[model samples]
Each structure stands twice: as C-alpha cells, then as structure tokens.
Target chain A: MRHRARRKVNQFILHCILLLGGALMVAPFVWMVLSSFKPSLEVISINFSFFPRRWTLANYIRVFREVSLGRAYINSLLVASCVTLSVLFSATAAGYLFSKLRFRGRDQLFILTLASVMIPPHIVLVPLYTLMNRLQWINTYQGLMFPFLMSAFGIFLMRQFIRGIPNDLVEAARIDGASDFRIYWSVILPLVRSALAVLGILTFLWNYDEFLWPLVVVHDNRMMTIPLILGHFTQAEAKFPGESMAACTLVVVPVLVVYAFFQTQFVKGISMTGLKG
Target chain B: MVAKRRVFNTYIILVASIVFIYYVLVCVWPFAFNLYLSFRKTDLLTEDKFIGLGNFRFLWKDPIFWRSLRNNIFYLAMMVPLGIVTSLFAAALIYRTSGIMRKVYTALYFAPVVTSMAAASLIWQLLYYPKIGLFARILSSLFRLDPNSLTFLQNPTTALLCIIIMDVWKDSGLRTVIFLAGMDEIPDSIFESARIEGASEWRQFFSLTVPLLRPQLIFVGAIYSINAIRLFVPVYMMTGNPPGGPANSTKVLAIQMYQEAFYGLRFGYGATISMVIFALLVGLVILELRSFEQRWEY
Candidate 1:
C-alpha cells in the first residue's frame, strides 16, 4: 500500500511537470490566435489579458485587402503540389533503378547523389540565382519549382524503402514478361505506398515552408508564396500586431490542420527521415 | 528475346539519363559554377575576371565576417547543449506517461515546428515587444524589472540570446520526440533488472539510459549545430527595423551571405562566405562523427 502511494505521488509530480511543459510549448500559438482576435489597439496595448476585450475580424479583412495573401496561398499550393509530385515521380524511378537494376557505375552514382545532400542551398545560392537569370526563369513558377523537383534525401529514402521489398516479387513479374515500367508502376509502386505518402507529405511541407529560394527568385508580388508574404507582412506592416497575427494565423492553419489529421504519419515520417538521431 | 532485351535496356537508360541530367543541371553545375565564381570577380552581368584568392582575402579582412562567424559559434554553444538537455528531460517525462496524454503533449510541442518560421518569428517578435509583450509583462512581474525598459531585440547584449531562447522553444518538441523514440528503443528488461537490484530511477537513467542515448544526443547536437550555423529566418524577421541589426548583433553567416550576394550584388564575395559556412559545417560534422565513433559501437 505504501509503495502504491509512492508511485502515485511520483506520477502526480510527472504529470505536473509535463502539463507545465505542454503549456509552455503551446502558449505562443494560443497567444497568437487570441491576439489575432483582439482589437488592434488592445493587441499592442500595455494591458495584459488572455481574453480579448472585444473580438473583431478587422485584422483578417485587412490582411486580405492590403496584401496579395490569396494569391500567395494559391502560389504556395501550386508550388508545393508540383514539387511534391515531381519529387515522388523522380525519386521513385531513380530509387527503383538504384535498388533493383544492375548497371555499370551505379554505386558511384549513388554515392554522388548522397554527397550532394551535404551541399547546403546557401552554398549554391549565387550560381543558382544566376542560372535562373540566364534561363529567364526568374519570377516564374518553373524557377521556383525546378531546383526542388528531386532531392537527394528523397531518392535515398525511396531507395531504402524499395530495397526492403522482396526480390521474388520482381522476379515473378519478370517471369510473366512485365516491362520495367509496368513492373515499377503496377508491382513496385503499390508496395511502397506508405513510403510514397510519407515522402509526398514531407516534400510538400518542405516546399511549402521554403523561404529563401522564393525570396530570391520571385520579385513579383503575384508570385510570392506564403512564407515570402509573411516575411513582407511582418517586415513592412508589423505596426499592426493584430493584422500580423491574423496573417500568421492564416499561414499556419492549413499546415496545422494537415498535421492534426495525419499526426501519427507525420511523426513517423519525421522519425524515419534520419533527421532525428 | 532481342526486342525484349532492347526495351529493358532502353527503360533503364532513359530513367537513368533523366536523373543524371536533372542532377547535373540543378546540383552539379550550380556547385561548379559557385566554385568558379568564388575565384572570379563577377556580379552575374559583369565581365568575369579570374582573381584567384581575392575574394578569400576580402573575407579575411572583413570584421563583419568574423563577427558573424563568432555569433554563429555563440548560437551553436547556447543552442546545442541547452536544446538537448531540456528536450531530453521533457522526453524522459513524456516517455513515462502513456495513452492520450502523450499524444496530446507531443502534438502541442510539435505545433511550432509545423508553423512556418516567418509566422513563428513574427509571433515571437510580438511576444518580445518591450512594453506590451507577454515576456516583458511576465519578467517585470517576477523580478520587478521595468517592462518598458527591457527592449530584448533592440539591445545588442540580449538580442542573440532572445533568438536562441525562441529557437530552443520552437525546436525542443521535435528533439523531445526524437529522444523519446530513442528511449523507447531501450529494452525494458535491463530497466526491470536494475529496479530489482534496488536502483533508483536516477541511477537507472545515468547507468543505462544516458549511454544508450549517446547516438541520439550526438545526432541532435550535430543537427542543431548545423541549424545554428545557418541561422537566418529569425535574424531576418525578428530584428525589426534593420534585419540583422541593432548594430549587427544578430548577424549570422547565412544572413551575411544573403546580404552580400543579393543585396550587395557581390556574388564572388557571397560565394566565399558560403564556402566558409560549408567548411565550418564540414568540420563540425566531422567532430560529431568522431565523438559518435568514440562513444558508440553499433
């Protein structure tokens, strides 16, 4: 009975600590949401209150009116979707070839791909910008979407997943005279559905959150993505904290909703991505 | 049979060629071009003149370059250990709990990671607003510090630290989850045996858990260090009037590179700075790998 009581006390202490930590983790987001609802004057005022004195939609209305936020949203969706689909197609094809096909210089090429992962985007920023300029692709979707069409990380991930698939299955398909493309499409693709989903979601998220490339490549307000618009909103129009918070809320809500629905898959994908130790 | 073999070979060659061409154009060519530009005096539109080591000499003489490098080191020093320890502690606590509570806590912590950095930085800037900000209000109430006087981002002494603290808060959730996953991988039998031997929770943690968590710790350290070295968005967004300002206190290498290349239109100088960043990251990665090797067998 005494031991049971000790365990209960320990659990209570753990609960208190975790609850506090959880609150700390979530408070900024809550504050962001609440401050968005507060009147503009109240948001920047000295009076501290968790609850808004008089809630308003003025900020949201102002955000839509003043900024190209709607266009930015559409741009973000288009870029993310295109990049995700392109990465999936390229990564899976390359991954299947690397994992299943026997070819000359395959290992060396794979190593080269892996080495490219270590090259930070900043390192190549100047040349890439110049290349985009030369191609007349600046301020264009093609420039924004081209560099990220496939990533070393995506190829590595797909390769790892594809390698895990049984050789017997591929052999059986081959015995029936299935073409390489047919085998890849019908047999291999379905088997790696979970990996595809994870890669697709991750690719989309990364592209959506991308800032620097978009900031550099797209000078046109109409071509700006969500992060770029948020940067502009904060830097240029941060005087109105309420409207800025509302803009933030808009920028964050879609990702948050996606995360909510796919929390488990998201967590699993993050862990499996080798990003975590 | 010949036709079939030809088709198979064609498919392989076609797919392989696509991957090769894409990577060469996007990755390989840009890297080579950056290297070449680093050695030349050019601003993309100007006549390219080969002036080997000139850019490096310029970088060597630039005090701002050194300051940015120092600031990056400071960020790395503060963020890595603090992030790891706090997240590890949180992970341990969460690992002890089970059911819906764990999921709720995990989701709450991870919310910030999913939020775009621009949005996160903007929200944090509001929080750190001197007079009316939440932080100022809390600190003033707790320690009687003048809330109106505490300009966290404006004051050079506190600016970088404020950003570090925000980064820690934003990142600890992901770190916590990673640590929890690592902890979960440890066999329960060892813990049960340790408990049966009358070992306290702390003893089991130190003796069994910490050693086992070395890989995770090293990995988290390396990643966070890489992130710290390349820190940009917060500095860009949070420093208000001038992006990396209040006398350039928050200036980092990545931000410096951006300013030099895009804003200053000195592509060669920017490429040199990027090379410096690359060298620094490679050195850190090597150090992390060495430590990882020395500590763990598997």
Candidate 2:
C-alpha cells in the first residue's frame, strides 16, 4: 500500500512536469489563434491579455481582401498535389525497377540516385534559377513544379518499402503473362500502399511549405504559393499583427487538419525516416 | 520468351531513363553549372568571364561572410544540444506513459513541427513582441524586469538567441517523437532486468537507455546540426526592417547566399558561399555515416 502511494506520487510529479512542457509547446500556437481574433489595436498593445475582450473577423477579412491569399491557396494546392502525384508515380516505378528488376549497371545507378540526397537544394539554387530563366519557365507553375517532380529520398523510401514485398507475388504475376509494367501497376503499387501514402503526405507537405525555390523562381504575385505569400505578408505588412496572425493561421490550418486526421501515419513516417539513418 | 524478356527490359529502361533525365537536368546539371559559375565572373546578364578563384578570394576577406559563418556555428552550438536534451527529456517522460494521454501529449508537441516555418516564425515574432508580447509581459511581471524597455528581436544581442529559442520550440516536437520511437525499440526485458538488479530509474536510463538510444541521438544530432547550419526562414521572417538586421547580426550563410545571389546579383560570389555551405554539410554527413558504419560493425 505504501509502495503504491509512492508510485502514484512519482506519476503525479511526472505529469506535472509533462503538462508544463506541453503548455510551453502549445502556447505559441494558442497565442497565434487568439491574437488572430483580437482587434488590431489590442494585438500590438503593451498590456498583454490571454483572451480577446472583443472578438472580430476583421483581421481574416482583411487578409482575404488585401492579399491574393485565395489565389495563393489554389496555387499551393495545385503545386503540392501535382508534385505529390508525380513523386508517387516516379518513385513507385523507380522503386519497383530497382527492387525487383535485374539489369546492367543497376547497382551503380541506384547508388548514384541515393547520393543525390546529400546535394542540398541551396547548392543548386543559382544554376536552377538560371536554367529556369533560360527555359522561360520563371514565374511559371512548371518552374515551381518541375525540379521537385521526383526526389532521391522518395525513390529510396519506396525502394526500401517495396523490397519488403514478397518476391513470389511478382513471380506469380509474371507467370500469368502480366507484363512488367502491368505487374508494377497491378501488383507492386497496391502492396506498398502504406509507403505510397507516407511518401505522398511527406511530399505534399514539403512542396506546400517550400519557400526558397518559389521565392526565387516565382516573383509574380499570382504565382506565389502560401509560404511565399505569408512571407511577403509578414515582411511588408508586419505592422498589422492581427492580420499577420490571421494569415499565419490560414497557412497552418490545412497542415494541422491533415496532421490531426493522420497522426499515426505522420508519426510512423517520421520514425521510418529516422530509423533509416 | 526472348521477345517478352526484351520488351520487359525496354520498359524498365524507359522508366529509369525518365528518372535519370530529370535527375540530371535538375540535380547534376545544376550542380555542375554551380561549380562552373563559382569560378566565373557573370551575373547571368553580362558576358561570362573566367575569374578563376576571384569569388573565393573575395569571400575569404569579406567580414559579413565571416560573421554569417560565425552566426551559423553559434546557432548550431546552441540549438543542436539544447534541442536534443529538451526533446530527449520530453520523450523519456512520454515513453513511460500509454493510452490516450500519450496520444494527446504527442500530438500537442508535434503541432509545431507540422506548421510551416513562415507561420511559426510569424507566431513567434508576435510572442517576442517588445511590450505587447506574452513572453515580455510574463518575464517582466514575474522577474520584476521592465517590460517597456524589453525588445527581443530588435535588440541585436538577444535577436539570434530569440530566434534559436523559437527554433528549438518549433523543432523539439519532431525530435521528441523520434526519441520516443527510439525508446520504444528498447526491449522491455532489459529494463525489467535492470530493475531486478536493483537499478534505480536514473541508473537504468543512463546506463541502458542512453547507450541503446545512441543511433537516434546521432540521427537527431546530425539532422538538427544540418538544419541549424542552413537556418534561413526564421531569421528572414522575424528579424528587423531589412531582415537579418540590427547591423547584420542575424545573417546566416543560407540567407547571405540568397541575398547575394538574388538581391545582390552576385551569382558567382553566391555560388562560392553555397559551395562553402555544401562542403560543411557534406563533411558533417560523412562524419555521421562513418560513425554509424563503425557502430554497425560493433
């Protein structure tokens, strides 16, 4: 009975500590959402209040009115979706070929592909911009979407997941006169659905939050993605903290929604990436 | 059968070729061009001239370049270890718990990781607002500091540190989840035996948990360091009027590279800075791989 009480005390202490940490972790976001609803004068006022005295939709309304946020949302959605789909198809195909097919120089090719992961995007920024310029793709969706169509990490991830699939399944399909392409589409792709989903989520989030490339390539306001638009909003109109918070909330809402619905998959995906290292 | 095999090989080749072409155009070609441009005197507008190491020489003496490098190193030193320690603590606490509580805590922590850096920076900027900010109000009232005098982002001495704090806050959730996953992989029997042998929780944690969690630690450490070295968004978003202001105190290598290339129109010089970043990251990655390889052999 004494030992049970001691354990309970310990657990209580742990909970206290964790809850404090959790509050610290969550405070900024709560503050963001709350501040978004606060009137503009109150947002930047010296006297900090946790909750707004008077709530208003003025900030959000201003966000929509002053900026091309609606267009930017559509732009972000289009780019993220296209990039995700392209990555899935290319990664799955390449993953299938690397894991199941035999060919000359295949190992070398796979190593080359894997090594590209080390080449950070900044290294290629200048030349890629120049290339985009030369190709007349600057300020175009193609420029924003082209370079990230497939990623080395995606290919490697798909390959790792695909290799786990039983060889007999592919063999059985082959024996049934299903061509390699058909086997890939009909057999391999479905079996690695979880990995595909993981890759899809990761790819979409990455493309959606991408800032530097779009900042450089797409100078036109209409072509701006969410991150770029938010960046501009913060940089240009930082005086209006309420509206900036509203814009920030708008930018974060979609990702938070996805995260809420797919928390397990999200955690699993992170673990898989971490464990791969 | 021979014809069928040939057709299959062709299909594979075709698919592989498409990926290869994309990689080459996007990755290889750009990289090769970056390397070439790093040695040339051209802004993509003028006729190209061979400047052979001129850009490097300029960067060698540039005070801002040195300052940016120092800031990046400072950020890495502060962020990497602090991030790992805080996340490890959070993970250790959460790892002992289960059920809905675990889910709630994990999600709460991870909320920031999913938020875009732009949004995270904006939110943090408001939090660090001088007199009106929540933190300023709390700090001043609790510690009896003057709230009206406090300026977090505008003050050069505290600006980078403020950014680092926000970064650690933003990133620790993901690190915590990763650490929790690592902790979960440790077999329960090991802990049971440690307890049977009369080891305290602290003793078990240090002796068993720490050593076993080395790979995850290394991973989190390396990734955090890499991210810190490439720090851009927060500094870009949160800093003063010109960004990286209060006298260029918050300027990092990645930001400097961007400014020099795009805004300054010094493509060759920017490429040179990028190569420096590239070299540093590759060195870190290689070291990480080597350590991991050694562990695998053991």
Candidate 3:
C-alpha cells in the first residue's frame, strides 16, 4: 500500500512536469493567435498580455490588404495538391512495379531512387533553380511543382506498404484477366489506402511548408504561397508585430485545425516520415 | 505467370521508362549540374569559364564560409543531443498518462509541429522582441533585469542559442512522438519485471527503457542532426537584412549558400557550398549508420 502511494506520487509529479512543458510548447502560437486581434498600439506596448487590450481585426485586415493572403492560400493549396497528386501517382506506379513486376534492373532502379532520398533539398537548390530558369519555369506553378513531382521517399514508402500484400492476391487478380493497371488501380490501391493517405498528407505538408525554393522561384506576389508571404512580411513588414502575428495566425491556425481534426493520422504519418514538421 | 509474361513485360517497360526519365530529369540531372556548376565560373551573365579547383580553393579560405561551417557544426552538436534529451523526458512522461489525458497532452505538445517554421519563427520573433515581448517580460521579472534590455535574438552571443531553443521547442513534439512510438513497441512486461524485482521507476527507465529504445535514440539523433544542418527557414526569417546578422553569429551553411548564389550572384561559389553540404550530409549519415552498426552493440 505504501509502495503504491509512492508510485502514484511519482506519476503525479511526472504528469505535472509534462503538463507544464506541454503548455510551454503551445503558448507561442496561442499568444500569436490572441495578439493577432490586438491593435497596433497595444501590440507594441511595454506590457504583454495574452488577451488583447481591445479586440480589433485591423491587424488581420492589414495582412489581407497588404499581403493578399487569399491569393497565397490558393497558390499554396494548388501547389501542395499538384505535388501530392504527382508524388502519389509516381510513387504508386514505381512502388507497385518494383514490388510486384519483375523487370531487368528493377532492383537497381529502385535502389537508385532510394539513394536519392539521402540528398536533402538544400544540395539541389542552386542547380534546380538554374534548371527552372533554363526551362522558363521561374514564377510559374510548374516551377514550384516540378522538382517534387516524384518523391523518392514516397516510392520507398509505397513499395514497403505494397510489398506486404500476399503474392497470391496479385496472382489471383492476374488470373481474373485484370489488366496490369487495373490490378494496380482496383486491387492494390484500395488495400494501401492508409499508406496513400499517410504519404499524401506527408507530401502535402512538406510541399505546403516549403519556404526556400518558393522564395527563390516565385518573384510575383500572385505566385506567393503561405510560407512565402509570411516570410515576405517578416522581411518587409518587421515593424508591425500586429500584422506579422496576424499573418502568422492566418497561416498557422488552419494547419493547426486540420492537424487537430486529423490528430492521430498527422502524428502517425509525421513521426513515421519524420518529414517537414 | 509465364504465359502472361509478355503482357507484364510491355506494361513494366512503359512504366519503368517514364520513371527512369523522371529520375534522370529531376534527381540525376540536377545533381550532375550541381557538380558541374561547382567547377565553372558563371554568374548567369558571362559565358561559362571552367575554373577547375578555383572555387574549392576560395571556399577553403573564405572566412564567412568557415564561420558558416563552424556554425553548422555547432548547430548540429547543440540541437540534436538537447532535442533528444528533451524528447526522452517528454515521451517518458507522456507514456505514463492514460486515456484522454494522453491525447490532450499529445495534442498540446504537437501543435507546434504542425506549424510551419516560417510562421513559428515569426511568432517566436514576437516573443523574443526585447521590450513588451511575452517571454522577455516574464524573464526580465524573474531575473530582475529590465525588459527593454533583454536581448535574445539581438545579441550575438544569444542569437544562435535562441534559434536552437525555439527549434528544440518546435521539434521536440515530433521527436516525442517518435520516441513514444518506440516506447509503445517495447513490451510492458520488461517494466513489470523491473518493478517486481524492486527496481525503481528511474532505474527501470535508465536500464531497461532507454536501452530498449537504443534504435529509436540513434534514429532520432540522425534525423535531428540532418535537419539541423539544413536549418535555414528560421534563420532566414528570424534574422533579416542580410539574413544572418548580429555579426554573422547565426550564419549557417544553407544561408551562406543562398546569399552567395542568389544574393551575391556567385553561382560557382554557391554550387561549391552545395557540394560541401552534400558531402557533409552523406558523410554524417554514413557515420551515424556505421556507429549504429558498430558502437551500440550491447
């Protein structure tokens, strides 16, 4: 009984500590969200408060007016969607083929793709930009989506997931006179739906949060993505903490909401890929 | 299977050809171009002139380049281990929670991970503002210092450390999840046995849980280190008007590369930095994997 009480106390202390740390982890964004509603004067005042002194949408109004975050949101959405769709298509086909179809040098090709994942995006930034310029893709949506069209990790992930299906399933499908693409589309796709979701979310988030490449490629405000515009404000509008926090709120709140909605999937997929986030 | 091999053969060829073409265009071609550009002197204006080892020699002696490289190594050293320790603590504590408390704690911790670094940096910059900043005010009162003079991102000494702190805060959630997943994979019976044997919880965690989580520790360490080397967005967003400021205190390889190629229009020099980063990335990954194989055999 004494020992059980001691363990309980220990567990209680641990919980208290974790709760404090968790609060610290979340406080900045919460503060940012709140401060977004502050007028410029209170935002720059000598005292800090979680609650704005006076409720106002002027900060958000400024961000919307000056930055055109609406266009950036659509741009981010379009780029993320296109990249995610392409990665899924390319990874799905490559994965299915590498796992199920026996071709000459198939293992070698898959290994080559696998090896590319080791190269982080930083290494290719300089050359990829020049290549985009050469192809006249700069400031175009194609520029934003081109390099990410096929994900090496996505291919590896899909192959790993697809390889788990029983060979007899594929053989059965083939015996039923299913076309190669048909088996891939109907039989294989449904089975790996969860992997697709995970990969799609992971890819979408990574591409969605991309800052450097877009900062390099997109010169037009119309071409600005969420991160790009947030970066723009940071560089250009550093004086206005109100507008900056409002921009931060606008960019981060939606992601946080989607993340809250898909909490388990987000954690599982992000922890699995250890991607962007 | 053999009878229908012809049909499979045709389909595979088509798909493989397309994938192979993409691989060449995106990965192999650009990678080769990066290497090729490193050897040439062309700033996108003049005609290309092969420089042989000129760029590498200049990079070897560039003080700013050396500073950036030193900063990167410093970042890798500080960020990864501190992050892992925090993660271990957070994850261990989290694993103790049950039911809805677990979900709430997890969500609370993970809110930062979902936020983009760009946005997070801006939020953190606000908190780090010398006067009237949330943390600055709180810390000033706690330390009996003036809020107006509290220099976090402004001071040369504290800039990189401040960035690392924010990063560790943002990234710990993801690392915590990874560690928690690893802990879940461990059998509860191990801890039970430790308890039955009169081992304390601390002893059990140290002896059993941590050792059992060796694979995850190494994995998270490597990932964090890789992420650390490519640290740009926060630094870029946080330090403006030359990107790496406060006397280049927080200048890192990625930022240096960006400034060189994009800002300075030194394409050759920038490619040289990329090559250096590529080398470091591959070398570090190889080193980590090798250590994983050889160092932790117990």
Candidate 4:
C-alpha cells in the first residue's frame, strides 16, 4: 500500500514537470499570437496580462494596410513554390541519374557536389550579386529563383533514398520497355515519395526563411519576402508594437501549420539529413 | 526498338546536361568567382586588378577581421558544448518518460526549431529589454537585484553571453531530438543485461549509453559546430547589424563578410573575408570528418 502510494506520487511529479516544460516551450509562440491581437498600449504595458481584456483584429488589419504584408505573403509563396518545384524536379532527376545511370566519374562528380555544401553562401554572395547584375536579372523572378534551383543536399538525399529502392524493380520496369524517364516518373517517384515529401518541406522552409539574398536582390517593396519585410519593419520605429507582433506572427504561421501537419516527416527529415551530412 | 533506344539516350543526356549546368551555375561558378575575386584588388568604383595573395596578406594584417574571427571562435566555444550537453540531457529526460507525454514534451522542445529566426529574435529582443524585460524581472524578484540596474545586450560583458544563451534556447530542441533518436537506436537487450548485472542507472547511462551514442555525439557536435560558425541571425537581429553598440563584441565572421560585401560594396574585400571563413570552416570540417571516421568504425 505504501509502495503504491509512492509510485502515485512519482507519477504526479513527472507529469507536472513534463507539462510545465511543454508550457514553457509553447509560451513564446502563444505570446506572439496573443500579443498580436492586443492593442498597442496593452502590448507594452507593464501590467500586461496574458490574455487580452479587449481582443481586437486591428493589428492584423493595420499590418495589411500599412505594411506590404499581404504582398509579402504572396511573394514568399510564389518564390518558395517555384524554388521548391524546381529543386524537386532537378534534384530528383539528378539524384536518379547519379544513383542508377552508368556514368563516367560518377563518384568523383558526387564528391564535387558534396564539397559545395562547405562553401558558405556568403563566400559567393558578392559574385552571385555581380552575376545577377550582369544578367539584368536583379529583382526578377529568375534572379530570385536562380541560385536555389538545385540543392546539393537534396540531390544527395535523393541519391541515398534511391539507392535503397531495390534494383530488381528498376530492372522489371526496363523489361517492360519503360524508358528511364518513365521509370523515374511513374515507378521511382512513387516509391521515393517520402523523400520527396521531406525535401519539399525543407526546400519550402529554407526559401521561406531566406533573408539576406532576397534583401540584396530585391529592390522594390513589392518583391520583398516576409523576412525581408520583417527586417524593414524592425528598422522602422518600434512604436507600432502590435503591428510588429502581428507581422511576425504572420511570417511564422505557415511554417507552424506545415510543421504541425508534417511533424513526423519533419523530425525524420532533420535527423536523417543530419546523419547524412 | 530503335525509337526506344533513341528516347532513352536522349532522356539521359537531357538530365545529365541540366544537372551539370545547374551545378556549375549555382554552386561551382560562384565559388570560382569568389576565388577570383579574393585574389584581386578592387573597390566599388575601380576595375579589379589581379593581385596574387595580397588580399590574403591584407586580411592577415586587419585587426577587425582577426577580432571578428576571435569573437566567432568564442561564440562557438560557448555555444557548442552548452548546446550538445543540455540537449543530450533534455533528450535523456524525455526518453526516460513514457506514453503520450514523450511526444508532448518532444513537440514542445522542437517548437523553436520550426519558427523563423527573425520572428524569434524579434520576440527575444523585446524580452531582452533592459529594465522591463523578463530577465530583469526574474533577477529582481529572486535575488533582490534592481531591474533597472541591468544593461544586458548593450554591455560587452553580457552581450555575447546573451546571444549564446538565446541560441541554446532556440536550438537545443533540435539537438535533443537528435540525441533522443540516437538513444532510441540502442537495443533494449543491452540495457536489460546491464540491469540483470545489478547496474545502477548512473552506471547504465555512463557505461552502456554513452559508449553506444558515440557516433551520434560526433554527428551532433559537428553539426552544431557548423551551425555555430554560421550564427548570423541572433547576432544580426538581436544585437543589430553593425553589432555597433558599446563595443562590437558580437560581430561574427559571417556578419563581417556581409557588411564588407553588401554595405561596403568592396566585393573583393568581402570575397576575401568569405575565403577566410571558408578556410576556417574547412579546418573544422577536417576535424569533424576525422572524428566521423573514428566513430564510424564503432
């Protein structure tokens, strides 16, 4: 009876601790969301309450009205979608080729791609900007989308994944006289759908959060992405605290939603990708 | 049959060509240009003149460049171990728990990893507000310290430290999740045998768990080290761009490169700093890969 009582107490303590940690982890996001709805005065008030006494959608309204917040959203979505699609297609094709095709210097070429991961983007930022300038692609869609079209990491990941698919399956497709493209499109893509899912999420996430390149390339406010806009907002006075919070909240929500929807894949992707690197 | 063969070769060539060109354009060409630029002497308005190893010599003499390099190393030194150990502990704690609670705690820890650094840093900048900030409030309540007396980010003593702490807070979940996955791979039989031999929890953890998790430790360490070197956002957003307050204590190599390139428009000088960063990263990568090979055998 005493042991049972002790066990019950231990369980309660564990639950309390874990729950508290969960609350702590989630508090900032909750705060960001909640504070976005509060009036500007209430946001910075020392006696600020957790829940707003007067909930208003005015901050969101103001963000949309004053800042190019809506335009930034569309810009992020368009740029990220294009980049993600391009990355998916090129990476999948290249990964398939590297994995299956009989090629000259395949291993050496792969190592060359692997080496690209080490060259920090900052190393090439100036030259890339120069290149873009020369091409007259600055502030253009192609300019914004050009550098991100093929990810070495994505190609490497797809190679690892395609290597796991049984060779006999590809052989079977070939026997049916299915061409390489057909096999990749119909047979291989379906089989490696999980890898595609992970890659898609990562590509979207990175492009969505990309700041410096966009900040540099994009001159017009209409072309600015959410992170770039947020930087602009920060540079502006900190007086519009509510609008700032709302804008931050807007920049964050899509990632949160995607992450929530695909938490398992997201976790798996991060861990597996880390191991690969 | 002839048509099919023709089609296959065409497809293969098409893909190969596209991949090769894209690789060269995006990855290879940029580095090549960076290499070229780094060797030249050029300002914004002048034509770049080839000056072999002169830019590197200039970098060698630059005090600010060296200071930034030193600061980055200091930041990495503080961040890497704290990130690794705290995450490992957090993962262990979560792994020890059972049922749905595990998922709940794991999700909470991972929340920060998914959020944008811009948003998080912005929120934290508010939290770091000197007098009315959460840090000040907590310190004042617990230790009888004055809330208004603290100057956190503006002070050299605490600015870098604050950045490191914020980084750990924002990213430890990723490390924890990684460690948890590593720990999950340890077969139950090993722990069962340890228990049968009357091993204490400490013994089991130290002897069985730590040894088993060597590969993961190396992986997490290497990854976090690379990430620490690229620590841009927290320093940039939280400390502000120039890192130019009381002292430029928080200026890192990436930020320096950025300023040199974009702000100063000395593309050649910026490329030089970038090459320096690349060399430092390469040095770290060599160390990491060696550790990888050693741990790989186990």
TM-score of each: 0.96, 0.97, 0.96, 0.94
Candidate 4 has what TM-score? 0.94
Regions more than 4 Å wrong, model 4 = A1-7, A45-54, B1-8, B244-246, B295-298
* A-chain TM-score of every model: 0.96, 0.96, 0.93, 0.92
* Ranking 1 against 2 by TM-score, winner: 2
Which tens-of-lDDT digit does each residue in A135-226 have in candidate 3?
99999999998878898888888888888988889889888988788888988889988888989997898899998889889898899899
Q: Per-residue lDDT tens digits of candidate 1, residues A191-256?
A: 989988988987888899888888889999999999888887556544788999999999888789
Clash pairs, candidate 2, are none
Error of 1 at B69 (Å): 0.5
- Write candidate 3's Cα lDDT for B83-176 as tens digits: 9999899898899888999999999988888789899988888788766677788887899887767778888988999999999998888889
| Clash numbers, per candidate | 0, 0, 0, 0
lDDT per residue for candidate 4 within A1-277, as digits (tens), equals: 9999998897788778767766877777787888889897777667747788899999999988888988888898999999999988878888888888765566777787778888745557887888898999998888888888888889989988888888888888888989888988998889888888878888988888887788778999888888878876554425777787888898887778877777778888887776675
Kindly report which residue pairs in candidate 4 clash with one another: none
1 against 4, candidate with superior lDDT: 1
What's the CA error at residue A211 for candidate 4, in Å?
1.5
State the displacement of the C-alpha of residue B133, model 1, in Å, after optimal TM-score superposition: 1.4
- Calculate DockQ per candidate and list them: 0.59, 0.62, 0.65, 0.51
lDDT-better candidate, 2 vs 4: 2
What residue runs in model 1 are displaced by over 4 Å at the alpha carbon? A275-277, B1-8, B288-298
Decreasing lDDT order of the candidates: 2, 1, 3, 4
